[model samples]
Target: MALAATVAGAPVHAQDSDWLSYRDAYRGMVAFEKYGKPKQFLQQHYQVGARDGSPLPVDFRLALSGKTMQLNLPLDAVGRAVFPLLKAAYDENAVLTVNRKLGAYVFRPRISIVVRPDGVYEGAELRAACEQALDFQRTVNAAGYRDKHCVGVRFTFAKKPDADVRWKGGAPLPAVPGPAFPDEAGNAYSVVTVRFDAATDKGQVVSQNAPLAVSPVFE
Candidate 1:
């Protein structure tokens, strides 16, 4: 909640130079789609953020526009959107636009472990999922992720008072205010982080409420 500022304080405007070419974005997204690796537990999304890597405003959006195509892209809590690979938009040379000044925002791909519908996860499964994500990053040439280890996972919940997350048959985990994904700039959410050290790696994490997303914590 505190991590994001409302758009009401920031004027939303359109600048020609701020638009991103759809063709270029398509190529970047296709690379992940074509990657052949052990990534069943991982997922990829197109994320929009400020050029300066600052936190995104609440209700932020990225739109796809062209001569004959117009669609609004909805963003998750972390400014990630499910990028649509539309052939029609590509043929029309559509551009991705946002309501911000020139050079204020950028778009990039984000990969993370998938969230389960049941809101329950095995510690070992989470570690394996993180490994899959890390391996995918290395193969894609993300030098920053190469040497890091999966130390934990972060569960981001909605801004509600009853967001409960804890270890199974145990007390609730400590809730902190932070971004859903590490290094992501956006509005803050209620987060419960679980570390995978020896004492804490054998139990199942249970979430009484569904989380918006679950991100791996690498260190």
Candidate 2:
């Protein structure tokens, strides 16, 4: 599986009784709902793209202030790793960072999505103006970024990875070599990531349906 190529540290395998799959479990979540509990946080994904809906090297660590550290898996690979829970304490107003290795250096690019009473966020505009400082380092990267390891980091929206960002929903995300997310500044960043205001999601329901079908869409 493509995700098997990307997972780190843990060997997540699907068995007759156990496996980790995110997109299927999430998409069919509606079929399993028996109770609805109000939640401040919801589960969503960081569907990056070489364009807008792609995945990155399986090695990058998408850290959310240690509250959640993700390896931005493709929808088909969520079982390998998932931030199954999103809490207001863990996500709201927290600074999110992407820590990855390029040869001998570690680059930490950051952003914060603080939910305001007015529902506004710092980098919702996704411009260099929205780029956060790299507390992990004080030096510009080999790429020559001044303060942050990135400048052109940007974002666009799409249907949730649960449905749209899949190998079958459209173009199969290539494990191609290039900046994972295209830079508006056109710099060749070694890694890029996406963020969601978990506290503002549509929330989940109790599933009553059979287990989700985790096969690759075109399989």
Candidate 3:
């Protein structure tokens, strides 16, 4: 509960100018499609535990910019969250006793990219960057065990190319429609992609490769 309470107080980082439009597009997508309701009980009340029957309480926060979703979890809190979740999912009387061992909870988020304008997009680069960030967080948390605090977090993105090229000064870009992804409970999430074009001084479209689609990955 403290974790959830603290999340609202967490300072959000300044969003990138180039990526701001994408964020709006993502919001629009959520509005048009029904992603259903989030598992408020699980997120707010569940506690992770270890096989030894030790309890873990992890605090988590999330943010989206461009095609990336950054997940922040305090080290101690993450350790707490993972253990309990694992305990509930696994058998307590099993010979292996998988829950006894302590390990890092790695969060790797990914996005599907669709480019409509037909240009070479650095999909691999984006994927790699997200993976690296997730890996690094795992490492940091592991190393900080001496302090009894480890923050296990993940960053992932799904990218899609946008074809909507109309953008007037101070106006939001148009939204592109798309299918929805269902969660563990079979609820659908409506995802939309919004594209912005880089233009020259004379208003000539320079590149369609600008960053597209920004929204909460797990909302």
On lDDT, the candidate that comes out on top is 1
Tell me each candidate's TM-score: 0.81, 0.21, 0.19
TM-score of 2: 0.21
111-201, model 1: which lDDT tens digit per residue? Answer: 7778888888887888888887777666665665668888888887776464687788989888877666776555457778888878565
Candidates arranged by TM-score, highest first:
1, 2, 3
RMSD of 3: 20.1
Candidate 2 positional error at 109, Å: 20
1-219: candidate 2 lDDT, tens digit per residue: 122211211122222221223432232222212213321222223322222223445554444433344434323221112333334423333333334321212111212222223322233332222232222112223122333333322222222222211111224222222332232122232221322234213321111111111110000
Runs in model 2 deviating more than 4 A are 1-46, 52-55, 66-81, 84-92, 100-219
Candidate 3's C-alpha runs over 4 A off are: 1-120, 140-186, 191-219
Best by TM-score: 1
Clashing pairs in 1: 1-188
Superposed model 1: Cα runs more than 4 Å off:
1-16, 50-59, 160-162, 185-187, 199-201
Better of 1 and 3 by lDDT: 1
TM-score of 1: 0.81
lDDT against the true structure, per candidate, is 0.72, 0.26, 0.24
Evaluated at residue 35, the lDDT of candidate 1 is: 78
